[model samples]
Target: MEEVLREIYCALDQVLRKGAYINIVFSGEFKHRSAVTFVVKGVVENYFSLKYALETLAPRGVKPALKPLLMAAMFMLKHGEIPGYAVVNETVAFAGKKFGSGVKGFVNAVLKKYPTLPEPEGIQKREAELNAPEFIIEALEKDGVDPKTVLRPPASDLVHFRLGRKGKTEDLSGLETLTRSEAGGWFSMPDTRLKELNASGKITFISPSSMECVNAFGDINGKKYLDVCAAPGGKSVYAAEKGAEVTAADLYPHRVKLIEAYADRMGVKLNALQNDALCRRQEWLNAFDCVAVDAPCMGLGVISYRPDVTINKRPGDVETIVPVQKAILSEAAEYVAPGGRLVYSTCSVLKAETEEVIKDFLKKHGDFSIYSYKNNTDFGRLIMPDGKWDGFFICVTEKKK
Candidate 1:
């Protein structure tokens, strides 16, 4: 138990102070301890809630060094199956050894009063219960999204995958399929079986919204396609599967390699290149029938999978990313041949990333116009995260011939 707490503290310190991503830290430090994994993930995922409770309990405010311990202890006490006394005692002892006897006394007093603390009132209560940051709450409300609906912990550990070459759906038997995409080969599966299937090259994981983005491109048979920011290439593979002659490009060589590896494993042919998406390439001007700018943004849509999107991200990040997304979009547009399709997409529901970026681009480029999808509005299609799918936005535009 002590070792588990220590591991949680060390890993969380990297997250809170060092700005390391939680998934990378967890995979490296805490993957071996299944029990500790649940507790640590719960604490980090519900950080604002735990911090709110701790603030009410410890009015002087907890120090950064001790916050992780309190947060983990509070999570265990409120959410874990462990006995309360064990949670309190073990945490207090861990505090004493790490901080000193004085800190231990402070921890003990606050935790002993935890159960009796009054419930937070109104918005704070709502915020704590939802485990949502104020900025996220405000943003969702501004976008007409009900925060309660989207701020949920993922209900299941199911991973979505598409069949690779030489793979059949029957090869992944015994797994329940939650949803199937119009692309025909895509389906969801219990994440428990992902490691074995992923290693065997029978399945390549992709988000359902991403699958939909590829489908939004309509028929790509024999069409020349450019994926401007393709990395860890799921969408590129999907485009190739749809019979597009795909060329995947990213800024860094390492990311380009990921696309190459994915293409190899899927038995698909696609050219991978390392080229900055923001730079204008004269040779690529009007060279492709379709262009996919999966521009990088705040990724608010994927908070359920990557909780750090809320914790590590600042409000300014949205502002910072807008121009970059616009620049990439402008460059990607140059690559689309006349009458060809340019699909601008992001794993973000924020209007700044989706509607605003496209709105701005349309204002500048008279040659392009929005081509609506089935449920799309003038702004674009904003797919909010449900229990099964991550939030996403896709807008397709056609260049005037």
Candidate 2:
């Protein structure tokens, strides 16, 4: 158990201090893999609250290196299935070996008082409860979404995938359905079943909004579609499934392979290649009927599952990424044929990523106007982060002739 806590501590430290993605951190083998994941996620989901509780209980505060350790132990004491005494003794012993007797005594002292210490409440508690950063909360509030309404932390550990046109649903066992299923869509499965599902060569594991963005192009049975930032090609493959001749491009070679692998698994074919979205192609200009730009952002909306996103992101991330989003959008607009559709989507609910980017784009591109498909607003629809469905911003705009 202490060993698992150590693993959890390292994982949290990577995400919290070293700027590593949680998914990347846990890709390696751990003795108690599931337990490590469970505890790290719990700590991430309750990060601010844990910090608040720790600070309130241990006002003098431990050093920066010991903070993650203390938080891991504290989270385990409150929420772990293991008994509190075992948690304390294991953590104290681990701390003594790693951080000397001074820090070890501090860890033991604080943890013993944690169960009796009053939990921090109000705004900090609210922030912890939501597990959202301050910038995201302010951005959502600016966009008229009440942060209070979506304050619960994420709980599910489900993977989303879809069986293509050829695969029969009845053949697969333990397949659970989600809300949006337009492109032969979503089925929740355990991580164990992924290999079995993938070996069938008729599945693509993508986010809900990945398929949703492609569905936004109403009746795209014979359209020319381009996913400018397409990698791991979810939207691109979905577009091909719906009978649009697909051309998916990403900047990196390895990512293009991911798209090809995804397409191959689903028995779907598309022209996948490595090309930077920032650079304009003369042949591609005004070519595609539907151009989808799944622009990269800080990923605020999907933080429900990837809680490490909040920790890895800095205060200036939204600002830093917005220009890139705009640049990609501007480049993508040229690829859309006259009177064709331009669909912009992101795994973010921030106005800066959603409305603000579009606002700036529309101001520059007079030929394009707000478009509607499947009941979306002018800028796009910002789905709040909930455990059941991912929070995505999808806007479908059109180029006028």
* Best-matching candidate per lDDT: 1
Residue pairs with clashing backbones, model 1: none
lDDT of each: 0.82, 0.80
TM-score per candidate: 0.88, 0.86
RMSD after Cα superposition, model 2: 3.2
Q: Count clashing residue pairs per candidate.
A: 0, 0
> Which tens-of-lDDT digit does each residue in 1-401 have in candidate 2?
66787788888888777877787787778888888888888888788778788778877866888888888888988898889999999999998888887777778889999999765577776667667667667766887887754445455666667777666666465555433354345656465556566677656566666677888888888889999999878788888888999999999999999999888877888999999999989999899999999999877666665767765556778888999999999999999999999999988777888888999999999999988766456677766766756778888899998
Tell me the spans in candidate 2 whose CA falls farther than 4 Å from its real position.
24-27, 57-64, 99-102, 149-160, 173-195
Position 366, candidate 2: lDDT = 96
